[model samples]
Target: MKISPLRSVRVTRYVTPLREGGSLPAIVEADDGFLYVQKFRGAGQGPKALIAELIGGELARFLGLRIPEIVFSDLDPALSRLEPDEEIQDLLRASGGLNLGVHYLSGSSTFDPVVNDVDALTASRVVWLDCLITNVDRTARNTNLLIWNRELWLIDHGASLYFHHSWENWEEQSVRPFAQVKDHVLLPYASRLEEVDAEYRALLTPEVFRELADLVPDEWLDDPASQRDVYAKFLTSRLAHSSVFVNAALYARNALV
Candidate 1:
């Protein structure tokens, strides 16, 4: 488990607020370049949210999905000069401090909530991955997805599986049905059921599983027995239904790719 050192960043000026995440995320210019700085919030879920941003984002990258660059840093609260409405400022302070940027969504904010212009085929691929990873987010309301510059980008994985680990149990770990895969904004361009199944089977290699487990932060894996048990249960459960979800995705995208 290697931790990357936080780089020293200098903010030139702040860009307008994006949206109010549990914490208010902002766009800021750093000495090196532009990056999203998410100030830490002090709520009960803040730590969990940060963990999801780090671990889940990295795992998605490992599984060959398109994700944004992410890192951890502390904002020198003094540098931020945003004058939010009094209520908003109080909420901001309650959140922790000034920060900028989060998972980046390229281009304008238009293709929000989910990816657009995708057919069933493409939707299958997205659904298969989401199902396997137990991504409970990406629903219609808070879809947590975006498309920019004609490429799909996933954001706000904080609501995914591992974030709520404490409340999870082995018995509750099962693949949810992908009946709505095709209509899912992020999964509209799905592959046919057959192809999606094959791809899912091919991608869930034991090595990939092990590596993904390894990326879990030491704090989460802090206890060897607990970590091993959790990973073992997670992998076994996910692998058990890989074919079903994968096939569903492929079936959706039968005509294309």
Candidate 2:
């Protein structure tokens, strides 16, 4: 369905602080009256986290995965005046501008692979996406996979593309074997990784890579088009040799079995 990027929505109210997180993300209601798990720019990770969320989530949706809709949410500084908590107050004030939000799943539960097994295709597609993006967060302890109405939805991709954290010479790092794949929650179940790799290689052409990388806001990159070009180059390079990671996954699964 070609889900696009950066649909802007103003945050109307902050329902509560998800204090569990160090960065102080929250459940907020937007002007559209839909609840979102918004990531604030004031947090330590700042826009980099939102940048990952947007690019990663959008790519997943494009590849036929059920990811929550992400939006550019505007936060009004005055709205934080109502909250008495000092820490949250500081965070709200710091995040008075545009923050990122992932549409909340109202009645969802964390995916427990042991209780509910994932089918081979879905598992393979997810593993493929995670490896391509270099997302290291989707491990057994923090699967970051959710199930709503018995359907799986991916969330919390703020950790993908960790190479961008230090872009000193990113090109050299992009195609490095995604060392963390061994811990991926879906790796063992993704027995069809090679089959999905062939299918996705055709879909994730250079045009698609540019389309997704361009979605990153210019402010996030010193040279928007140049960085986009880099992003495309890095991703296409990985996709070109995707079998390296697929082969690694096959070896991992074989060892486990």
Give lDDT tens digits, candidate 1, residues 1-257: 32233233444445555565545566655556665645344433655565555545665665556666665444444443475555444544554332223544546354554336765545555566676666667766666656667766667666555525674564455554555454455554443545765766765565555555554445433474566556545655766777765666556545323
lDDT of 2 by residue, 177-237 (tens): 7878889988878988888998898777877878888888776667888777887888888
TM-score of each: 0.67, 0.95
Superposition TM-score, candidate 2 onto the true structure: 0.95
RMSD of 1: 5.3
Question: How many steric clashes does model 2 contain?
Answer: 0
Number of the top candidate by TM-score? Answer: 2
